[model samples]
Target: MKRRFFCSTLFFITPLLILACNGPSDPGSNFSSGSVTPPLFAHSVKSLLTLSVIEPADPKRATALGQYLVWLVQIDRNGEPFPVNAISIDGGMPAHGHGLPTQPRVTAQVSEGRYRVEGLKFTMPGRWILNFTVSSKLGNDRFSLEIDVGH
Candidate 1:
Protein backbone atom coordinates (compact mmCIF):
# COMPACT_ATOMS: atom_id res chain seq x y z
CA MET A 1 0.00 0.00 0.00
CA LYS A 2 2.79 2.47 0.90
CA ARG A 3 4.76 1.72 -2.29
CA ARG A 4 1.70 2.25 -4.54
CA PHE A 5 0.94 5.64 -2.87
CA PHE A 6 4.52 6.81 -3.32
CA CYS A 7 4.55 5.88 -7.05
CA SER A 8 1.32 7.77 -7.76
CA THR A 9 2.61 10.85 -5.91
CA LEU A 10 5.88 10.73 -7.84
CA PHE A 11 4.09 10.55 -11.19
CA PHE A 12 1.91 13.59 -10.46
CA ILE A 13 4.66 15.66 -8.90
CA THR A 14 7.17 14.86 -11.63
CA PRO A 15 5.04 16.39 -14.38
CA LEU A 16 4.28 19.44 -12.25
CA LEU A 17 7.93 20.02 -11.57
CA ILE A 18 8.82 19.79 -15.28
CA LEU A 19 6.14 22.28 -16.22
CA ALA A 20 7.19 24.72 -13.52
CA CYS A 21 10.77 24.62 -14.68
CA ASN A 22 9.87 25.46 -18.28
CA GLY A 23 7.31 28.18 -17.52
CA PRO A 24 4.24 28.94 -19.62
CA SER A 25 4.42 28.86 -23.40
CA ASP A 26 3.18 31.92 -25.26
CA PRO A 27 2.06 31.42 -28.86
CA GLY A 28 2.72 35.00 -29.91
CA SER A 29 6.16 35.20 -28.35
CA ASN A 30 7.91 33.84 -31.42
CA PHE A 31 10.71 36.05 -32.67
CA SER A 32 10.61 36.28 -36.46
CA SER A 33 13.80 37.39 -38.17
CA GLY A 34 13.93 38.56 -41.78
CA SER A 35 11.30 37.43 -44.36
CA VAL A 36 8.85 40.03 -43.09
CA THR A 37 5.78 40.51 -45.22
CA PRO A 38 6.09 43.61 -47.38
CA PRO A 39 3.87 46.59 -46.67
CA LEU A 40 2.14 48.76 -49.24
CA PHE A 41 4.62 51.56 -49.82
CA ALA A 42 1.99 54.18 -50.54
CA HIS A 43 -0.11 56.55 -48.47
CA SER A 44 -2.18 59.71 -48.86
CA VAL A 45 -0.89 62.33 -46.49
CA LYS A 46 -3.86 64.46 -47.38
CA SER A 47 -6.36 65.00 -50.16
CA LEU A 48 -3.83 67.15 -51.98
CA LEU A 49 -0.91 64.77 -51.94
CA THR A 50 0.06 61.08 -52.12
CA LEU A 51 3.45 59.57 -51.46
CA SER A 52 5.03 56.33 -52.69
CA VAL A 53 8.35 54.53 -52.44
CA ILE A 54 9.91 53.73 -55.80
CA GLU A 55 13.25 52.19 -55.04
CA PRO A 56 14.64 49.09 -53.34
CA ALA A 57 11.18 47.75 -54.24
CA ASP A 58 8.53 46.51 -51.85
CA PRO A 59 9.60 43.55 -49.69
CA LYS A 60 13.05 45.07 -50.07
CA ARG A 61 15.56 42.47 -51.22
CA ALA A 62 17.94 40.90 -48.73
CA THR A 63 20.39 43.67 -47.93
CA ALA A 64 23.69 42.67 -46.41
CA LEU A 65 24.55 44.08 -43.02
CA GLY A 66 25.79 47.69 -43.17
CA GLN A 67 25.08 48.21 -46.85
CA TYR A 68 23.97 51.47 -48.47
CA LEU A 69 20.56 51.58 -50.18
CA VAL A 70 18.78 54.18 -52.27
CA TRP A 71 15.15 55.13 -51.89
CA LEU A 72 13.05 56.85 -54.53
CA VAL A 73 10.19 59.12 -53.63
CA GLN A 74 7.26 59.94 -55.86
CA ILE A 75 4.45 62.38 -55.25
CA ASP A 76 1.07 62.80 -56.90
CA ARG A 77 -2.01 65.01 -56.76
CA ASN A 78 -5.39 64.32 -58.34
CA GLY A 79 -3.92 61.26 -60.11
CA GLU A 80 -1.22 63.32 -61.78
CA PRO A 81 2.44 63.65 -60.86
CA PHE A 82 3.06 66.82 -58.87
CA PRO A 83 6.21 68.20 -57.36
CA VAL A 84 6.43 69.56 -53.84
CA ASN A 85 8.41 72.63 -52.78
CA ALA A 86 10.67 70.53 -50.57
CA ILE A 87 10.67 66.98 -49.29
CA SER A 88 12.36 65.75 -46.14
CA ILE A 89 12.92 62.09 -45.27
CA ASP A 90 13.55 60.27 -41.98
CA GLY A 91 12.78 56.84 -40.58
CA GLY A 92 12.76 54.57 -37.51
CA MET A 93 11.36 51.44 -35.95
CA PRO A 94 8.74 52.38 -33.41
CA ALA A 95 8.57 48.89 -31.95
CA HIS A 96 12.31 48.87 -31.35
CA GLY A 97 12.27 52.35 -29.81
CA HIS A 98 15.03 53.59 -32.11
CA GLY A 99 15.60 55.73 -35.17
CA LEU A 100 17.50 55.12 -38.39
CA PRO A 101 21.20 54.38 -38.41
CA THR A 102 21.93 57.07 -40.99
CA GLN A 103 20.56 60.41 -42.10
CA PRO A 104 19.05 60.05 -45.57
CA ARG A 105 18.73 63.17 -47.68
CA VAL A 106 16.66 64.06 -50.73
CA THR A 107 19.67 64.93 -52.78
CA ALA A 108 17.88 65.96 -55.98
CA GLN A 109 14.59 66.13 -57.76
CA VAL A 110 14.59 63.36 -60.33
CA SER A 111 11.72 64.77 -62.30
CA GLU A 112 8.43 66.59 -61.93
CA GLY A 113 7.26 64.59 -58.97
CA ARG A 114 10.13 62.21 -58.17
CA TYR A 115 13.10 62.60 -55.86
CA ARG A 116 16.24 60.61 -55.19
CA VAL A 117 16.96 59.52 -51.63
CA GLU A 118 20.58 58.90 -50.69
CA GLY A 119 22.57 57.64 -47.72
CA LEU A 120 19.94 55.13 -46.65
CA LYS A 121 21.11 52.05 -44.77
CA PHE A 122 19.58 49.28 -42.73
CA THR A 123 21.55 47.71 -39.92
CA MET A 124 19.22 44.82 -39.24
CA PRO A 125 16.19 42.95 -40.40
CA GLY A 126 12.99 44.40 -39.05
CA ARG A 127 10.13 46.76 -39.75
CA TRP A 128 11.06 50.43 -40.34
CA ILE A 129 8.80 53.38 -40.87
CA LEU A 130 10.02 56.04 -43.27
CA ASN A 131 8.63 59.51 -42.67
CA PHE A 132 8.34 61.90 -45.57
CA THR A 133 7.41 65.53 -45.06
CA VAL A 134 6.07 67.05 -48.25
CA SER A 135 6.09 70.84 -48.26
CA SER A 136 4.68 72.85 -51.12
CA LYS A 137 2.88 76.08 -51.98
CA LEU A 138 -0.40 74.56 -50.84
CA GLY A 139 0.89 73.48 -47.47
CA ASN A 140 2.76 70.62 -45.79
CA ASP A 141 1.70 67.02 -45.40
CA ARG A 142 3.42 64.04 -43.81
CA PHE A 143 3.37 60.48 -45.08
CA SER A 144 4.95 57.20 -44.02
CA LEU A 145 6.28 54.15 -45.83
CA GLU A 146 6.71 50.91 -43.90
CA ILE A 147 9.66 48.91 -45.19
CA ASP A 148 10.81 45.43 -44.26
CA VAL A 149 14.57 44.99 -44.48
CA GLY A 150 15.62 41.40 -44.86
CA HIS A 151 18.86 39.81 -43.75
Candidate 2:
Protein backbone atom coordinates (compact mmCIF):
# COMPACT_ATOMS: atom_id res chain seq x y z
CA MET A 1 0.00 0.00 0.00
CA LYS A 2 2.81 2.46 0.83
CA ARG A 3 4.59 1.66 -2.45
CA ARG A 4 1.45 2.41 -4.48
CA PHE A 5 0.95 5.72 -2.63
CA PHE A 6 4.58 6.76 -3.26
CA CYS A 7 4.28 6.00 -6.97
CA SER A 8 1.06 8.02 -7.28
CA THR A 9 2.60 11.02 -5.48
CA LEU A 10 5.73 10.82 -7.69
CA PHE A 11 3.64 10.85 -10.86
CA PHE A 12 1.71 13.95 -9.79
CA ILE A 13 4.75 15.86 -8.50
CA THR A 14 7.01 15.15 -11.50
CA PRO A 15 5.15 17.45 -13.93
CA LEU A 16 4.98 20.24 -11.35
CA LEU A 17 8.73 20.01 -10.69
CA ILE A 18 9.53 20.15 -14.41
CA LEU A 19 7.25 23.14 -14.95
CA ALA A 20 8.70 25.04 -12.01
CA CYS A 21 12.23 24.41 -13.26
CA ASN A 22 11.27 25.76 -16.72
CA GLY A 23 9.91 29.20 -15.67
CA PRO A 24 8.76 31.90 -18.13
CA SER A 25 12.00 33.81 -18.85
CA ASP A 26 13.37 33.29 -22.38
CA PRO A 27 16.51 34.26 -24.39
CA GLY A 28 14.71 36.96 -26.50
CA SER A 29 13.26 38.93 -23.61
CA ASN A 30 13.58 42.23 -25.52
CA PHE A 31 10.68 41.52 -27.88
CA SER A 32 7.73 43.79 -27.00
CA SER A 33 4.82 41.54 -27.95
CA GLY A 34 4.19 38.13 -29.53
CA SER A 35 1.74 39.19 -32.26
CA VAL A 36 2.88 41.18 -35.32
CA THR A 37 1.18 44.54 -35.98
CA PRO A 38 -0.22 45.30 -39.43
CA PRO A 39 0.29 48.68 -41.13
CA LEU A 40 -2.49 51.33 -40.73
CA PHE A 41 -3.11 52.23 -44.37
CA ALA A 42 -1.33 49.34 -46.05
CA HIS A 43 -3.50 46.52 -44.73
CA SER A 44 -6.73 48.56 -44.80
CA VAL A 45 -8.12 52.03 -45.61
CA LYS A 46 -9.42 52.81 -42.13
CA SER A 47 -7.41 56.04 -42.09
CA LEU A 48 -8.04 57.62 -45.48
CA LEU A 49 -11.60 58.98 -46.07
CA THR A 50 -12.80 61.29 -43.32
CA LEU A 51 -13.28 64.79 -44.77
CA SER A 52 -16.56 65.99 -46.32
CA VAL A 53 -17.45 67.89 -49.51
CA ILE A 54 -20.42 70.18 -50.34
CA GLU A 55 -22.75 69.32 -53.15
CA PRO A 56 -22.15 70.91 -56.55
CA ALA A 57 -24.89 73.17 -57.98
CA ASP A 58 -26.78 72.25 -61.13
CA PRO A 59 -26.75 74.60 -64.12
CA LYS A 60 -30.51 74.67 -64.79
CA ARG A 61 -31.56 75.25 -61.17
CA ALA A 62 -29.98 76.27 -57.86
CA THR A 63 -30.78 72.80 -56.50
CA ALA A 64 -27.76 70.94 -55.12
CA LEU A 65 -26.57 67.89 -57.00
CA GLY A 66 -26.55 65.50 -54.10
CA GLN A 67 -24.53 62.60 -55.39
CA TYR A 68 -21.56 60.74 -54.01
CA LEU A 69 -18.70 59.92 -56.32
CA VAL A 70 -17.62 56.34 -56.92
CA TRP A 71 -14.39 54.90 -55.61
CA LEU A 72 -12.14 52.02 -56.64
CA VAL A 73 -10.26 50.19 -53.89
CA GLN A 74 -7.34 47.85 -54.33
CA ILE A 75 -5.40 45.76 -51.83
CA ASP A 76 -1.88 44.51 -52.47
CA ARG A 77 -0.08 42.67 -49.72
CA ASN A 78 3.25 42.32 -51.57
CA GLY A 79 2.57 44.17 -54.83
CA GLU A 80 0.05 41.43 -55.69
CA PRO A 81 -3.69 42.02 -55.96
CA PHE A 82 -6.18 40.16 -53.75
CA PRO A 83 -9.98 39.97 -53.48
CA VAL A 84 -11.98 41.95 -50.95
CA ASN A 85 -15.67 41.91 -49.95
CA ALA A 86 -17.76 45.12 -49.99
CA ILE A 87 -17.40 48.84 -49.20
CA SER A 88 -19.97 51.32 -47.82
CA ILE A 89 -19.92 55.16 -48.04
CA ASP A 90 -22.51 56.84 -45.86
CA GLY A 91 -23.35 60.47 -44.87
CA GLY A 92 -23.55 62.88 -47.79
CA MET A 93 -25.11 66.35 -48.58
CA PRO A 94 -28.57 67.93 -49.38
CA ALA A 95 -30.77 66.41 -46.66
CA HIS A 96 -33.62 66.01 -49.15
CA GLY A 97 -31.40 64.93 -52.03
CA HIS A 98 -31.50 61.43 -53.44
CA GLY A 99 -30.86 59.00 -50.64
CA LEU A 100 -28.08 56.39 -50.91
CA PRO A 101 -28.92 53.11 -52.62
CA THR A 102 -29.54 49.94 -50.62
CA GLN A 103 -29.20 46.90 -52.89
CA PRO A 104 -26.88 45.75 -55.73
CA ARG A 105 -24.34 46.51 -53.04
CA VAL A 106 -20.88 47.78 -53.91
CA THR A 107 -18.76 44.67 -54.41
CA ALA A 108 -15.22 43.84 -55.51
CA GLN A 109 -16.37 41.34 -58.10
CA VAL A 110 -17.86 44.04 -60.34
CA SER A 111 -14.45 45.47 -60.97
CA GLU A 112 -11.97 42.79 -62.02
CA GLY A 113 -8.74 44.29 -60.69
CA ARG A 114 -10.11 46.64 -58.06
CA TYR A 115 -12.91 46.91 -55.50
CA ARG A 116 -15.57 49.35 -56.62
CA VAL A 117 -17.82 51.51 -54.41
CA GLU A 118 -20.72 53.59 -55.69
CA GLY A 119 -22.60 56.48 -53.99
CA LEU A 120 -19.64 57.92 -52.16
CA LYS A 121 -21.23 61.38 -52.31
CA PHE A 122 -20.78 63.94 -49.53
CA THR A 123 -23.64 66.02 -48.11
CA MET A 124 -21.72 68.99 -46.72
CA PRO A 125 -18.09 69.82 -46.08
CA GLY A 126 -17.25 68.43 -42.67
CA ARG A 127 -16.08 65.14 -41.14
CA TRP A 128 -17.21 61.72 -42.40
CA ILE A 129 -16.50 58.09 -41.75
CA LEU A 130 -15.86 55.70 -44.66
CA ASN A 131 -16.35 52.11 -43.61
CA PHE A 132 -14.86 49.32 -45.64
CA THR A 133 -15.73 45.64 -45.31
CA VAL A 134 -13.12 43.19 -46.54
CA SER A 135 -13.82 39.45 -46.86
CA SER A 136 -10.97 36.94 -47.06
CA LYS A 137 -10.52 33.21 -46.73
CA LEU A 138 -9.50 33.77 -43.12
CA GLY A 139 -12.57 35.84 -42.20
CA ASN A 140 -14.56 39.03 -42.82
CA ASP A 141 -13.46 42.27 -41.18
CA ARG A 142 -14.57 45.92 -41.10
CA PHE A 143 -12.32 48.97 -41.31
CA SER A 144 -13.15 52.70 -41.08
CA LEU A 145 -11.15 55.04 -43.33
CA GLU A 146 -11.22 58.84 -42.99
CA ILE A 147 -10.81 61.09 -46.02
CA ASP A 148 -10.96 64.89 -46.39
CA VAL A 149 -11.73 66.13 -49.89
CA GLY A 150 -12.53 69.84 -49.60
CA HIS A 151 -11.81 72.40 -46.88
Off by over 4 Å in 2: 1-42, 45-66, 85-104, 107-113
- Which tens-of-lDDT digit does each residue in 1-151 have in candidate 2? 9999999999999999887776666545566666432222333544322211111222112112345455445555445565554444443223335433432246444443355555455544433444556556535556554433332
Structural similarity to truth (TM-score) of each candidate: 0.67, 0.43
Worst 10 residues of 1 by lDDT: 56-65
lDDT of 1 by residue, 41-132 (tens): 56656767777666656544423346786767778887777888887778888888899889988998999998888887878787778788
- lDDT of candidates 1 onward, in order: 0.75, 0.45
TM-score of 1: 0.67
